[model samples]
Target: MTEFNEKQIDILQVAERLFAEKGFDGTSIRDISKEAKINIAMISYYFGSKEKLLEALIFSRTADLKIQLENLRNEAIPPMEKIDRLIEFYVHRINKNKCIYQILHFEFSSQKRSVDFKAFTEVKKSNLLSLEKIITEGQDLGIFKKNIVIALIPPTILGTYFHFNMNRPYYEEIFDLKTEQDYDNYIKTDLTKHIQQTIKALLVYEN
Candidate 1:
């Protein structure tokens, strides 16, 4: 992805937040301009259209994950460790970019697809394929069991996180979370461990 200028980045951030809060169809250039403190003409000048802007946002947000996956694939570490790190990376990324991830989750789940759905799915497919390659390598090395449903693996990880994220208020009470730092710590440590264990159980051979 090309480097985004400061204004472009600002617009993207505002757009992501609005799209997450108000659905892509609900948000307009005027809303973005109002929130971003910029003129609508500038958004047009930079991105041409709302669909193109969304496409850029999705690609830019996912570009690093793609590179990270590629790097992880070539690392000398054990495949299970790679999977663990991938899960950790995902948890951190989603937590950090909560709004963008929510927007992505909505885009994936919505029945009325957006114009940028193609770009979104492409990014999604690329990331899934990367994870699949790592899992396949593990199977080849006898580290993971064969006949695992590769398609289910991503949703298992993603859905779990989404459920926790979307129900944060309920979870806060259940977990007695009082502070922002407390919630972050809980998710990173306890929740992350649970996900790692679940995926390990699914992938590892049962004796």
Candidate 2:
């Protein structure tokens, strides 16, 4: 995440919430300025434009994840442990900031293309390549199955989380969740474990 001053952070936070609630197209710069209690010129001065602001928001949210993954590649830990940590990191982050998933889902599902989509795709590709390296290391050590398709792992982990997040409201309704904390607890515990186990199974299972 690019470091921002308090005011920039404030603007980004409000923008994220509005984007989650109203979506990118539905939201206006005026909406963000009003919600953030900042002048219109300030936002433009800080972020260039709404498109760049969205880009900054995505970078802010994902930069840490990218850093974490990069650090994992250098750690002396075993491959399985690295995988476990990766899963934990993603789950915990998503649990803390549900808006990241909301923005991703909205961007992917929208008919109109976002200028920042290409940047987002490049970020994903880099992360996936990093993951593939870890998986390949495991295969070399005969820990992960040789037949495992490295490309599929990222999508499997990400897709599962995204699917659950997009359908969270339905799940909450079905399960009769009365509070946000209740739902967060369920994701932090149950969903995290499920994804970890599923990924491990895919990596180590015999055909």
Candidate 3:
């Protein structure tokens, strides 16, 4: 993971929150300065511009994910175990970085041309490719079913988690969750297991 000094980290965190709440286009350097209790000069000195700041935030958030995925790829484990681990990693990460994921989803869905968008797209593409490799390895071993669409797997896993996270309020109401902890528990336990099982079944299913 990339390391940042305290001031830069503060600015990035504030920018992430602002971007999540307002949006990339909606946020300004002044907004981040005010929220971070830092001056505009410091932000400019550290990050150069609002767009660069967004890039820094994306790099910071994605670096760990990239490393984790690489490590999973290298680990001496069965393909099925790797898939389960990937699912669990994503569930935990999405829950922990809800705001970051919100901004990422928004940015990608916008389909605009910019440095930040490109950087985010590259990171996402790398992750998807890593996932595809895992699936391909399984197929080579005759563990995963042939003719499975590798490209769709990432979207299926991430989209399901995103849908649940985005609609938490509705879920909370429907499930009668009385506390934030209750909802989190449900996700960590039931939701995680369901996703793992679903993916495993899809991988092993005979046509």
Candidate 4:
């Protein structure tokens, strides 16, 4: 597990909230300072610059996710169980820290071509690695169908999170889900059920 100092987390918390609210370029150092209720010098002292603070958020989130995913990746679990656990982990993680999905989807949508993209790349690749391992193992053991959309599952699953978490305005207006409680019911009752059903459809079935 990666241990972040209190100061680092404080800086990241401010950055995540600001980035979610105002976006990357739209947010400024002074804004973070004021929101964080810390001196501007502390922001600079910890992260160096506003740009670097944003990058820190990206890196920190990905790194933390990578660690959690690894712990859940065990060969003993059935592929379907593995798959379900992964989905549960993602949903739980995002719900616990809205900023995880919020900041990630926020920056990714910007299309600014960040230098820290590789940090995200590693986390994604690690996740894909875990998925592929379980999938191939299932295939070898005759637990999963031979023809599976294994490669594309990564993007599709993660994309679902992005679609729902990032597109708040659309859901609020279209589905009348503006409050946290409404959104909670949506995720637990509908959104999570939807993702698992889709995953079942994607995996090849050979009976």
Q: Candidate 4, residues 111-136: lDDT per residue as tens digits?
A: 66554566567677887887788778
Q: Residue 2 CA error for candidate 3 (Å)?
A: 4.6
Off by over 4 Å in 3: 1-3, 111-115
Candidate 3, lDDT over the whole model: 0.84
Clashing pairs in 1: none
Candidate achieving higher lDDT, 2 or 4 = 2
- Candidate 1 displacement at residue 122 in angstroms: 2.2
Summarize candidate 1's per-residue lDDT along 1-207 as a digit string, tens digits.
457989899999999988987889999999999999989999999999998898888877877877788888889999999999999988887788787777776666877755555665776788888889999999999999987988788788878888998899999999999999999999999999999999999998575
TM-score of 4: 0.81
Weakest 10 consecutive residues of candidate 3 by summed lDDT: 111-120
Q: Please state every model's RMSD to the true fold in angstroms.
A: 2.1, 2.2, 2.2, 3.2
Distance (Å) between predicted and true CA of 177, model 4?
6.4
State model 4's lDDT: 0.75
Estimate candidate 2's alpha-carbon lDDT, on a 0 to 1 scale.
0.85
Q: Which candidate gets the maximum lDDT versus the true structure?
A: 1
Where does model 1 exceed 4 Å of error? 109-113
Looking at model 2, the pairs that clash are none
Residue 94 in candidate 4, Cα distance off native in Å: 3.3
In candidate 2, stretches whose alpha carbon ends up further than 4 angstroms from where it belongs are: 169-178
lDDT of 2 by residue, 44-161 (tens): 9999988889988887787778888999988999999999898988788776778867787667787776565666667778888888889989999999998888788777877888
